[model samples]
Each structure stands twice: as structure tokens, then as C-alpha cells.
Target: MKIDIVSVFPEYFDVMKLSLLGKAQAKGLLEVSAHNLRDWTHDVHHSVDDTPVGGGAGMVMKPEVWSECLDQLLGLDTSAGADEPSISQGPIVIFPNPSAPLFTQADASELSGAQQLIFGCGRYEGYDARIPDYYRAQGVDVREYSIGDYVLNGGEVAVAVMLEAITRLLPGFMGNPESIVEESYTGSEPLLEYRQYTRPTSWRGLDVPAILTSGDHGKVDRFRRDEALERTSQLRPDLVERLDCSQLDKHDRAKLGALGWDLSGEHPRRTK
Candidate 1:
């Protein structure tokens, strides 16, 4: 996939050259380029932000500068009619903001399938609201997302977080595709991944689960499933509540019952 990142602090993206992203680019599976938002500025200071019109604490990114940058990247004619056909098949545009919906693994999976992506990394307050509003009016696939509830100084770090999540899902980006499948929050029935152990049979007096060491693959599989269920129930009951109980077999239901999970719609009570 081709990705274009427009940020005032383009230098912050240097970390993209270090790991899986770097490998993906080297292998021709991905192409990433960072552009300075100030490059579109015509003034001596190359200023990209201005004081809010209604008077706010932080300066807002100037829409005209953002328009120029986006137009250049998309090959659009700024003077053309708003109803005119887009100059190019525009890439999916992403704007990271604290007010938008949360980004999720599902979103990463969807975006990884796109052939092109463009990220607008906002600084100071944020992009003028009109930026996305204008593009969306032209039928462009524009999305505004937030990584979490917290705020950040800028969207540069958010872009990196999103890129890493999306890139890893691309085919051949990961050494083993199975690694993606077995990870938490993936597949039809999402659940936290089972705990893992490596190497030492006995480390600091804590031994690896004997079920793992056992040659009985079926038993090991059952053990892992149970552990995953137990962990998810203990940590994220919300996930458990969303589960399709009808899909569980008698054995699975019995296990959940043992864990005080109410299978009959009433609140569960521990049975000693």
C-alpha cells in the first residue's frame, strides 16, 4: 500500500524506518512518504496555524494551507468547481482527533485492505473542521479517528500507532500469518489471547503448564480455550456479555457455569 503522511513535525516519523514498517517498505509491499505541512505555505514564516475565529485557547490549523497541501497530494484543481470530478481517485483520508470515534483492530483490518492511505496529522488545536467537511462533500472516503480517550500534543504519534496496526495486517508483512490470526481481538469470536511461555521448563521455580509439555495436542487445545475464556471473563466481562451463548456446546457451557457465568439470563452466582 502507498501511504502519505502530512505533518508539521515530519521528523517525528523517523521511527517508521526501524522495524516491520521498514521491512515492508524494503520488500516493496509498502511505500510510505512524509511531507511537511509547511511546504504548502507561501509566507516567510511558513505558518500553518492561526488564532481561532471565535477566540479559543489554541490556534487552529489554517484551512487554506491544508487545502493547498491536500490539493497537491490529490492532484485536485483548487479553482475547479466543487461539483467537478475529482482530479484523481483520492486515497482514504484519515484525520486523527481526540473527539472522533476510537480506532480499533477491526478498523486496522479494513484499512489494511486499501491500496492507498493519506494521514493528516493535526497540531495545535486541530485541522479546521471544514477540511473533512469539504472532502466528504466531494464523495471522498474521509475518516476521523481517535486512538483513545486521552489527548496528545499532535497527531504524529497517532499516525505511527495507526500505521503499525494497519501495516502488520497486510499480507506478507508478518513472517507468519498465523500470528495475526491467533492474536487477541481477531477472528469471528474475539477474545484475549492465551498466555504463552518459552524455553525454560522451570524458571525461578515456576514451571511451564504441564498441559503444554504434554504430547496430547487435544488436551492442550482444550486447556488453552478454557484459559482464554477464564481470562476474558475475569478482565473484560463486557466481551463475555457480547458472546453468542447459543454457539457454546454443552461442554463449553458447563465450563462457563463453573466460572459463575449466568447461562440462563439471570445474574450468575458462584456454586461451591
Candidate 2:
């Protein structure tokens, strides 16, 4: 996949060269580039932001410079959509905004299928809202997602977080593709992964679950399923709320019942 990042601090992406991401680039599975947003500036100091129009506290990124940068990258002749690249020719455009819908594993999985993606990193207060609206009207597939509920100093960090999530899902990117198969937030059922243990069965004082070392795969699988259900219900009830109760077997329901989860409804809920 091809990935383009537009940010004032292009140096931030240098980390991409350090790990599996770098290996992906070397293997020709990925092509990544970072472009300085200020490169499109035509004036001295290459100013890209100005005081907000509605007397806001912080400066808002200027759309003029952003438009020039995006137009070139998106192969659009003008902001009005002139000579706009088609779905096949253009890449998906994304912006990281704290106020936008939260980014999720589902989103990452979907984007891993795209051939190319361009992420615009916002600074200061943020880029003009019109930027995304304009491109969307021009028939570009645009997305604005927030990594979390809180805010960040800039989009670079959010881009990194999202990029890692998406790129790792690409076929052959991971040394062991199976590593992602049973991970949390993946598969038909999104649940936290069961706890893991390494050798030395016995740790400093605690020991690996007896079931794990019993050589009984059936009992071990049941133990893990029970643990995952309780762990997810305890820490991420929101995910649990999305569960399809009908899919839970008698054994699964019995375990959840012990935790006060009411599965009679369309979605699971903790009674108390």
C-alpha cells in the first residue's frame, strides 16, 4: 500500500524507518512518504495558519495552503473538482481530529484493503472544516477520525497510532499472520484476548493457570473463553454491549450469568 502523510513536522515520521514498518517498505509491501505542509506556502515564513474568524483562542490552519498541497497529492486540478482523480486513480484522504468519530480496529481492517491513503495532520486549533467538506463534495473518499477521547498537540501522533494499526493488518506484513487472528478487537467477536504465559510455569510466586499445563486442550480452551468473557465485561463493557447474545452458547451464558450480565436483551448488559 502507498501512504502519504502531510504534516508540518515531517521529521516525526522518521520513526517509520525503525521497525516492522521499515521492513515492510524494504519488502516492497509498503511505500511511505512524508510531505511538509508548508511546502505549498508561497509567502515568507511559509505561514499556514491565522487567527480564527469567530474570535477563537487559537489559530486555525489556512485552507489555501492546504488546498494547494492536497490538490497536488490528490491529482485534482482545482478545489472545484476540476480534473479530479477517480476512485481508482485517487487515494483515500483522512484527517485526524479529536472531535471526530473514534477510530477503531474495524476501520483499520477496512483501510488495509485500500491501495493508497493520504493523511493530513492538523495543527494549532485545526484545519478549516471546509477542507474535508470540499473534498467530499468533489467525490473524494474522505475520513476524519479521532484516536481517542482526549486531544493531542498535533495529528502526527494520531497518524502514527492509526498507521501502525492499519499497516500491520496487510497480508504478509506480520511475521506470523496468525498473531492477529485471535487478538483483541478482531474476528467476528470483538473481545479482549485471554491472558498469556511463558515458560517457567511458576513465576516469582504465582504460577501459570493449572489448566494451561494440564495437556487438556478442551479444558484449556474453555478456561480461556471464560476468562476472555469476564475480562472484557469487566474492563470494556462497551464492547460487551455490542455482543450478540444469541451467539453465546449455554456454557458462555452460564459464565456471564455469574458476572451479573443480563443476556436476555438484544445486547448484553450488567445487571448490577
Top TM-score model: 2
Question: What TM-score would candidate 1 get against the native?
Answer: 0.93
Candidate 1 residue lDDT tens string, 66-150: 9888887776765756667465765899999999999988999999999889999999998899999998887779999999989
- Please estimate how well model 2 matches the true structure, expressed as its whole-model Cα lDDT: 0.92
The C-alpha stretches of model 2 lying farther than 4 A from their native spots are 79-88
Instruction: Extract clashing residue pairs from model 1.
Output: none
**Which portions of model 1 show Cα errors greater than 4 Å?**
80-87, 265-272
Residue range 1-272, candidate 2, lDDT tens digits: 99999999999999998789999999999999999999999999999999999796999999999998988888876546546544436689999999999999999999999999999999999999999998899898999999998999999999999999999999989999989998999988999999999999987998999999999999999999999998998999888889899999999999999988899998888898
* Worst lDDT 10-window in candidate 2: 79-88
lDDT, candidates in the order shown: 0.87, 0.92
- Clash count for candidate 1 is 0
TM-score of each: 0.93, 0.96
